[model samples]
Target chain A: MTFPMGLAGPISGLVCGVLFGYVLQRGGLGNGCRLTAQLRLQDWTVFNVMFTAILVSAGGLYVLELAGVMHAADIFIPTTFLWATLLGGVLIGVGMAIGGYCPGTSVVGAAAGRIDGIVFFAGLIIGVVAFAGIYTPITPLLGAAAGPQAQTLGDLLGLPAWAVLAILTGVAAGVWWFTRRSAASPAITCAD
Target chain B: MMKQRPIWNSHAAGAVLGLVLLLTFVLTGHGLGASGAPTAIAAAAANVVAPAATQANDYLGWMVEGGRNPLNSWITWEVIGVALGALAAAWWSGHLRVRLEGPPRANNSGRLALALAGGILSGFGARVSAGCTSGLGLSGSATLATAGFVFLIGFFGAGVLTGLLTRRMWK
Candidate 1:
C-alpha cells in the first residue's frame, strides 16, 4: 500500500494536520500560560496529556503492526545522536520554559491571536536560517555523534515490540497515577 | 459576547490525539510535524536570496534539490492545515483574543521578547534533534524509538531546571 506522493499526499497531510492541531488546541496546549505552568510543576496538564498520548500511540502502533496492517519497521526511525540530542534538548527545554511554546504549539498560539505566539514563530524561522547557515560545518559533528541505528526499543532491549510497549505503558501508568495524586494537592495555582 | 468554552479533558483529548497520530501514520507513512514547514520556508527564502549557496548547502540544498519548489511539500501543506485548524478551534472556544500572553507580572513587550528568544532556541534545537515535539516527541516515541525517549528526558529535565530559574517571570 504505497501511498504515492503525487496529489493525495498533501491532501492527507492537511487533513491529519488539521486533526492534530484541533486536538492539541482543545487540550489547551495553545495557551502559553498553561505550558509555562507545566514546566514550573504547578500544573500537570502537559504531562497528563502527553503521557496519555504517548501510551495510546505506542500501544496502537504495536497493535496495528500485530494485526498486519503495517510493519513497525517500515516507519521512520530517527537515528540517535547522544550529544546533539542532549544539547538540543537543553536548548529546547530552556526555550519552552521561557517562551512557553514549542514550534507546534506556537502555531496554535498565533492562531489564537496571541502576539507573543506570532513573535515566537518569527524567531523560529530565524533560528532555522541560522542552523542552515552553519550546516556545512555542523554536519561532521552531528554525524560523528550519531549512535546505534536501532529500529525500536524492542531491538535494543532484546524484547518483542509488544513486550517493550507493555513495560513502557506500565511505567507511564504508574507515573500518571502519581501525577493525578499530586494534582489533587494544592500545588497548582491559577495561572490561566 | 461569545461564551467561552473550557478545554476538553486532558485524558480524552490525548486519546483523540493518539488516534489522530495513528491515522496520520497509516495514511501518510510518517507522523505529524511542525518545524519542517518553517525549515522549508526558510530554504525557499534562502533560495531566492542565494540560489547557488542554497543549492550547495547540506541542509537547505536537499529541500530545494534540482530547483524544486520547497513549499510544494506535504509538510508545508500540513502546517497550513494546522493554522486553519487552530483558527477554527480558537473561534469556537472564544479564545481568539489579540493580546500578549503570560503572567500579569510580565509586561507585553517583555513577554514578546522572551517568546522570540525562546522560539529561536527551540527552532535551532529542533533542527539539531531532527524534529519538534510532534515529529520527534510524539511520533518517535509512538514508534518506540530510543532517540525519542532520550530527547524527552533531555528537554523535560532542562525545562524543569530552566523553569525553576525563571519562576519570577511567571510568579
Candidate 2:
C-alpha cells in the first residue's frame, strides 16, 4: 500500500534519511579508505555490511508483503533493461574504485568534511547535466535490451516470496562465510 | 577533545541500516536514494541559468516543468537530512576532520581529480541504470528485482578489476 505522503512526505523522508545516514556513518561507510577496501578485496566490511542490510530488508519487506501489511505492486521497482543496467553498473564500479565513493557515500562523506567527497558531488552535478545534454542520443541505447515488465525473482522463478527469501538467505550466508574465511587467511588477502 | 570511537560491529550496524531502510519504504512508499538530489540540483541550477532551454531538455525538463521546484523533491529533503545526520555522526564519533583520503601513492591533487572523474562516471551511470548502489543495488535487490542483481554483478565485477589495475594507486 502506498503511504500517503501528503505534506508529511518530505518531513518523514528527512527523518528517515537522517537515521539512514547516521547508521551508514556508524557502519564505517563515511570513510573513503574503508569503502575502497572492498574494491581491493583487502577488507570485507562493505560486503558484510551490505549483504546483511540486504537480507534484513528483504526479509522484512517480503515477509510483510506476505503478511498483508505491504503490497509489492505499490513499491517502486525500476523497469529492467539488461544491457543498460550492466553497462551502467560497469561504469559505476570503475568510478567507485577510482573515487572511493558512490553517490550516497559522497554526500555523507562531504557532510563529514571530506573534500574529495564534495568534489565528487560537484562532479555528479556536472555529469547529470552532461547526461541531460546528451539525453536524446542515449535514449535508444538505454531503452534497448529491456527485460520482462514488473517481475521479481520470486515471480520469475515461480517461487513464493518466503522460498526466495530462504534461498537468498542461504546464498548470503555462504558468501559471508567465504569472505570471512578469505579475510582470515592473510596469505591471499592484500595488506590493508 | 573526546577520542574517536571505534566503529560499530559491521553486522549490527548493518541490521540497523536495514531497519532504517524498511522504515523509509513503509513511510514513503519508496526506498532511500542519493542520486536524485544531484539531478534535481542540476535541474534547478539549469533553470536559473537557462529557464526555457533547461525546461525544454528531454531528460531534465520534467523536473522543471510548470514552474515546478525541483528542490521540493523527496530525495532533496532526504539528502539534506543525510548531510545533517552525517555531520552529527562525525562530530559524535570525533571523526570530524577536513582532509583528503587516499593511498600514499596518489597525491592530493591527483586523488581529487580522480574523484571528480569518478563522480562524473558514477552520476552518469546511475542515471543510465535508473539508480545508484543504494537505490538499485540495495533497494532493488531487496525487492528481488533482476536488474538489481545484474547491476551488482557488473558493478562488483568491474570494481574488482579496476581495483586490481589501480592497485598501485591504492596499495
Candidate 3:
C-alpha cells in the first residue's frame, strides 16, 4: 500500500539523504582506510554500521507494513537475474577491495575531497556505458537468465518473509554486540 | 580550515543511518540508491548520440524503466543531495580537501592509476550486479531478499580474496 506522500516524499528523501551522509562521514566510512580495514576484517566498523542499518530498516519496515502504512516499492525489488546477481556480486566485491569505495560511499569520499573518489566516479560512468554497449551481445548469457523470481529468502524457504527477517534481525544484533564487545577488548580479535 | 574532528562512534553512526533509511521508505516508498544517476547519464549520452542503439540493446533499453525520464529520476535527485550532504558533513568536520588516498610509498601518478583501475572495475561491477553495497546489501537484505544475501557473500568473499592479493596497494 502506497502511503499518502505529496511534497513530503521528496522533502523527506532529501532530509534522509543528508542524515545518512552525515552519519557515514562521521563514522569514517568515507575514508578509504576504513573501507579497506573492513575488507581486511581488521576493523569491524563497516560491518557494524552496515548490519545495524539493515536491522533498523528491516524492523521499521516490518512494523510499517503491519500497520498498512508501507509496502515495498516495485522499483527497489531486485529481479531474480540469478547469473547477474552471482557474477555481478563477485565483481562488486573485487571492485570494493580494489577501490575501497562503493557507489554510495564514493560520493562521501568525493565530498571529503579524495581524488580517488572522483576518479572512481568517472570510471563508474564509463563502466556503465561500456556495459550498455556490450549488453546486447551478451543477451543470451546475461539477459536471458533474467527472471522475476522475487528472490526473497522467504520465497526460497517456503516461509514468511517476516521469519527470515526475524532471523536476520537476531544475527545483526548478535554481530553488533560482538563487534562492540571485541572492540572493547584489546586481544579478542585481530580486528577492533 | 580547522583540524579534523574525531568521527562519531560506529554504532551510533550505523543506527542513525538506519533510521534515515526507515524515514526514506516511509516517505518515498523506496529506499536510498546510489548508482541510478550514473546509469541515467549513460542513457542520456546514448540518446544524444546513438538514439537507435539505446533501444537496440536490451540492457540499454532499461535506462527508461516505466517509460520515465531516466535523467530526472528521484534517485538522481537524491544522489545530488548525497553529494551536497557529504560536502556539508566534510566541511563541518574539516575533512574537505584535495588528497590522494593510498599507501605511503605510492606516488601521485601511481595512486591515480590505481584509483582509475579500481573505479573502472567497481563501476562495471555495480552495473552488472544491478546494485552496490547500499542497494543490494543494505536495502535488499533489510527486505529479506535472497539476492542481497548472495550479494553480501560474494561481495565480502571477493573483497577479502582481492584484498589479500593486492595488500601492497593500501599498506
State the lDDT of candidate 3 residue by residue for A1-192, as single tens digits. 466243334556567667767778887788877787667665778888888788788778778778876665532556657777777778777777777688888888988889888887777787888887777666665654665566677777888867887787788778767766544444312111
Report how far residue B125 has shifted in candidate 2, in Å: 0.5
| Highest-TM-score candidate | 2
Q: What are the candidates' individual DockQ scores?
A: 0.69, 0.69, 0.57
Query: Model 2: per-residue lDDT, tens digit, B27-124?
Result: 86678889999999999999999999898899999988999999998889998899988888888888788887766698889889988999999999
Question: Better model by lDDT, 1 or 3?
Answer: 1
Cα deviation of A42, candidate 3, in Å: 1.3
1 or 2, greater by lDDT: 2
Model 1 misplaced stretches (Cα beyond 4 Å): A1-8, A181-192
DockQ of 1: 0.69
Model 3 clash pairs? Answer: none
Tens-digit lDDT string for candidate 2 (A43-118): 7778888888888988888778777877877777766798888988898898889888889999888888889999
Instruction: Summarize candidate 1's per-residue lDDT along B57-103 as a digit string, tens digits.
Output: 88888888987998988888888888889888888877777878865
- What does the lDDT read for residue B110 in candidate 3? 74
* Worst window of 10 by summed lDDT in candidate 2 chain A: A183-192
Interface RMSD of each: 1.9, 2.0, 2.6
For candidate 2, give the lDDT of residue A27. Answer: 81
What DockQ would you assign to candidate 2? 0.69
Candidate 3 has an lDDT of: 0.74
